[model samples]
Target: MTGYVLRRVGVSLVVLLGLSFIVFLMLHTISDSPGRAVLGPKATEDAINAFNAANGYDRPVIVQYLAFLGNLLTGNLGRSYILNEDVSTLLWENAGRSAMLSLSALVLALCIAVPLGIAQAIRKNSFLDRAATSVSYLLYATPSFLIALLLIALLSQAIPLFPAEASQSSSPWAVFTDTRSMALPVLTLTITNLVVFSQYQRSSALEELGQDYIKVARAKGMPERMVITKHLLRNACIPLITLIGLQIPILLAGNLIVESVFNYPGLGLLFLNSLNREDYPVLLAYTLLGGVLTVAGNLVADILVARADRRIELTK
Candidate 1:
């Protein structure tokens, strides 16, 4: 496991390097020198040139890429051009809030999805099963932004349960104490994941139920409830580990939309604000980090699947 983890980390680093380069190239290709954007139109050409040289943007693209990789090795993520703050600091502050919201939603989703899935799987084609399937499909097919809108309309505007939009609360850990600011955003993510994960869980449970071990356990006079819990669910939930790990990107993408809709101050909101301001440093760093996180999530999923099922070989 140690060797496997080390290998995965090495590979992730390489991929992250390539990802950063690509994001750097893309940002430069689309937007001109940060100098002009910074110095404004009235600034003289010499001033702009001085700004570029001072910032190291005057170097060749490859040179800039090398510098980026070097800085990354030393744990420097460059300063935000617009905000004049360390990109890493900004990310640390905001990413924690995003992670908190995402984690809360994940917990809520699992609590609801697991039981519902097991029940549906146990019942097969019963009315309850069919209803669950229909509901899951309906939600899975709906866009997250649309879900947010519906939630705002029904829960916020009509019922006035949660605030219509989240306040710009910068306190990362405050959501745990203040349920009011978190309810709508967390609900939006929970509903979305509940729809997606329930389907996966149901299918996994059904597959596990049909396995030979389940029959053997039942034939050995194991109680029905015991068989379901001790044997069936234990095996059935393995796939869910992988599913959650692999779905990290989808979860973050959902965060983008949900945060935007709810005015939640997270990475999505930060990304939007950066785009509006044409803040190249923040934008590129965020995009690069996003790729890194996606790859890291997949690596974790692979590790988890291997750990949960010995038949799966990590080295292979």
Candidate 2:
């Protein structure tokens, strides 16, 4: 287990390194430069060159990349050229909001989806199953961003029940205290993710139902509830754990669209803003943070799966 963990951690470090390189490459490959963006269109060539030199953009790309990586190791993410704000400060502030929104949505989706999945598996081919399957297919096929827009229009604009923007609160706790403002964004994520989660979990349960252990449990006079809960549901939920981990990153990305639509001040929106301004420092920081999150999520999933299934070895 120790070796397995060490291996995974090594791979995760390599992944983050690769991701950092990609982000650095993207910063230069694009036609637009931070110097130009900061100096504005009317600025002369000399001013742009001066800005670039001052910011070390004049350095060899390899030197700059190494320096960037070193800075990251030392917890120095640099400053946003346009706003003159520390990238780390901005990331921490915005990341908290995004984490709150994403986690709330994830919890809400899991609560509804798991039970709905179990019900569908229990009553396979029945009216509830058919109806739910149809709806799940419909929802899972639809785009999350499109649904987010519609929710904003109907719930925020038409009914005026919730605030359109999700950035009303500074922190997660504050978000709940200002629950009305959070209603629309949370609902939008819950709806979209519930469809995805229910479909995946229902399939996992159905697969478990076909397994021989389920039949053996039932044949041994296990109560229907006990058989389903202990014999089937527990195993079925293992796959869902991995799916949950995978969805964390997806949810973070999805928040870009949702937050943008609602004018929320989360990391997604901040990333978008940085993209618009060609803020390489801020973008690089987010890329690293995202890579770390993905690595951490996959590691957590692996540990959970290992815990769930003792027969399975942790090593590759």
- TM per candidate comes to 0.94, 0.95
In model 2, which runs have C-alpha deviations exceeding 4 angstroms? Answer: none
**Per-residue lDDT of model 1, residues 1-316, tens digit only:** 7777788788988887778888889999898768888777788999999999999988999999899889988989999888999989988888988888888899999999998999999999999999999998998899988988998899888998888787677887756877886888889899999997898999999999999999999999999999999998889998898888767777777888888998888888888888888888888878887787799888898788778777675444
Check candidate 1 and list the clashing pairs. Answer: none
What's model 2's TM-score? 0.95
For 1-316, candidate 2 gives per-residue lDDT tens digits of: 6666677778888888888888788766774667888888999999999988998888988999998889988999999987789999888888888888888888999999998998899899999999999998888788888888788789878988876776566765655777788888888888988998998889999999999999998899999999988888888899999988888788878888888877788988999998888787887788777777787889888877877776554436
Each model's lDDT comes to 0.86, 0.84
Find the number of clashing residue pairs for candidate 2: 0
